[model samples]
Target: MVIAVRTKNTQTVSDYNCNGRHVFTQTRELERPLVGSILQSMWGVSPTHLTWSALHNSTLVDYSWSVGQTPFGPFSEMSTLSFAQKDAARRNVLLTSLNYSISSAIDVLDSVAAHGGERKLLKHNQYVEFVQRWSLFKYKLDKAVSALSHFDFELALYYLRSLDHDLYGAHAIVYHASQELEASLACFKDPPFPWATVSVYAVCVVAFIYVYMKRDKLFRNKRKQF
Candidate 1:
């Protein structure tokens, strides 16, 4: 989701685009596993007015950090610093997150090979790993575009340098990110359902996995909060 961060620059407020993507960010950067479970639950949630409005109005809360533009409730407060102090820290955080996602996605996919998990039944923890990889794939694509919005080119480069680790999956991400950049002005003009599309899809995928694969074991267990 594109959160236009309007900063009070004296009398004139300037709008700066900050993409707040907390789920994938938490998973990759903060090493949070519950983030994936949260996405899964959001997808299958029985839609109600409270849930809908909460998701709709809850955009990125942090303006200074490298938060991707997301509609889901995953964002956190920016690092404890002023906006200017956050610029460099944000870039580093983005870079670290991209690296972590790429590495984690590759490992999870490799672990889930047909022969990898031979246990007859599905394990909740194991399924959580699957959710993360699926999420990592989509998020890598969406975040690539969001990174560009916040001048996170170095972070992009970091992801590119490691493309060899998973070239096949990386192709879709790299390709989509380019198309997204080309369409940025169009998105900036109207946003055109960027976060809504990605987050909704993420929510659905997670919910499906939780219900069909994990069978509510995930929800029954208390998840650690971000």
Candidate 2:
């Protein structure tokens, strides 16, 4: 037999109410597609490809798509996109996920003039570098999306996953965004190199050293005995 337990959050009714949430939330979501469209144009993709829903500001349209088959295999097309979509998707991902205003990129630059921690103040320049890298990835991802339009569903699907997880997930960023959203924020991951590789490399190196020493000892013993 088992007993169950439940507890309510400690906050009172007033604590649960928020006045500015909807305004901020909607504004935030709206910022994504709008900013995305800007990024798209910057990359030379036509503006029509980036479409938003009439019912809600959050839903974006995948208006561009084509389907045909070739040596690669049969394929059904889902969307048509451009480098701008890719860049916008990435920018949108950062803007939405991190609570960074559309101006976060600019804010980093402005921060240098305000002055605070010597280290912290100079760090914004590094941030500018990271934002540039993210933009580049988006540009590449859009190219991937456009190129994938020709193949059968299976192969095309594989290509999409390779580009971005959000592209496959239910919501799909409501815009074709890259999958590296989480990884993009950190800007880099230290190579822990993973356990399997470390174990394998370690074992191989150890084994090779042991064999070499054993052979040397055998030769020395034979020489001394002789």
Candidate 3:
């Protein structure tokens, strides 16, 4: 996720790379997150896509934003705006995208539960704990959305990233549950017969019968000679 932002003075965009991420003049710096999030969603690059596109195409919409222009929807509208409006637009883009991502992720978790496969797929304790953890995350997600709507980005960002540890736990629980399910399924599978052992026993029995028949014949001949 390397973003190189330069002013119109920069003719050769390819040659320049900066160590610090924030290279824009004061105005552009504030707009970076909003622009980045929308572009990431639209472009489907570096991270998850913002909007759905054709399976082969990375970008849902081909669009870019410029200074002093309202980057609204798929189309740009030229409008006059005070500094406050510009700030509001930036906040809206960032918070709205964050809300969408959180909702999508939570929906997947809920869908898994809705399938009624949790009992067969997950251990009793694991299923219970995962439900509890996801419930907590859902609560925080609601709080984060509320905070973002109220323009409290700092608190929203805090709550959004706070799911890191619980997310890891969720992943671990799912992995272990899948493994357990695989083992259980394997138990129901029929095992292959040991054909090699059976063949060896068959050969030994034939050889023993041959040897006994030969001995019996030899003894009859000896008795007839006597």
lDDT per model, in order? 0.44, 0.40, 0.59
What is the lDDT for 60 in model 1? 34
Q: Where is model 2 poorest over a 10-residue stretch in terms of lDDT?
A: 69-78
lDDT of 1 by residue, 48-153 (tens): 1122236567533433332332222334323233333335345555556566666765654454443334132224554454454455556555657576566877
Comparing 1 with 3 on lDDT, the higher-scoring candidate is 3
TM-score of 3: 0.41
Best by TM-score: 3
User: lDDT, candidate 1, residue 9?
Assistant: 43
In TM-score terms, candidate 2 sits at: 0.17
TM-score: the better of candidates 2 and 3: 3
Q: After superposition, how far is residue 188 of candidate 2 from its true place, in Å?
A: 40
TM-scores for all candidates: the values are 0.22, 0.17, 0.41
What TM-score does candidate 1 reach? Answer: 0.22
Ten-residue stretch with the least lDDT total in model 3 = 71-80
Give the per-residue lDDT of model 3 (tens digit) for 1-226.
5455545452222322235432232333325445545544654323211334679565564333333344333222233443544455556665666766567566656756654567766777988988877777778778877987887877877877776456657756766766555332435668899899999999999999998979978889999999
RMSD of each candidate? 33.2, 29.1, 13.3
Candidate 2 residue-wise lDDT, 1-226, digit = tens:
2222333542222212224432111212233344334544443333443455777866564533312211110122223344444544454443342233224433433443344422333235534544454465455455444544442334433433443432222122211222322332546767775899889999999999998879978898999999
Give residue 219's lDDT in candidate 1 (0 to 100): 59
C-alpha lDDT of candidate 1 relative to the true structure? 0.44
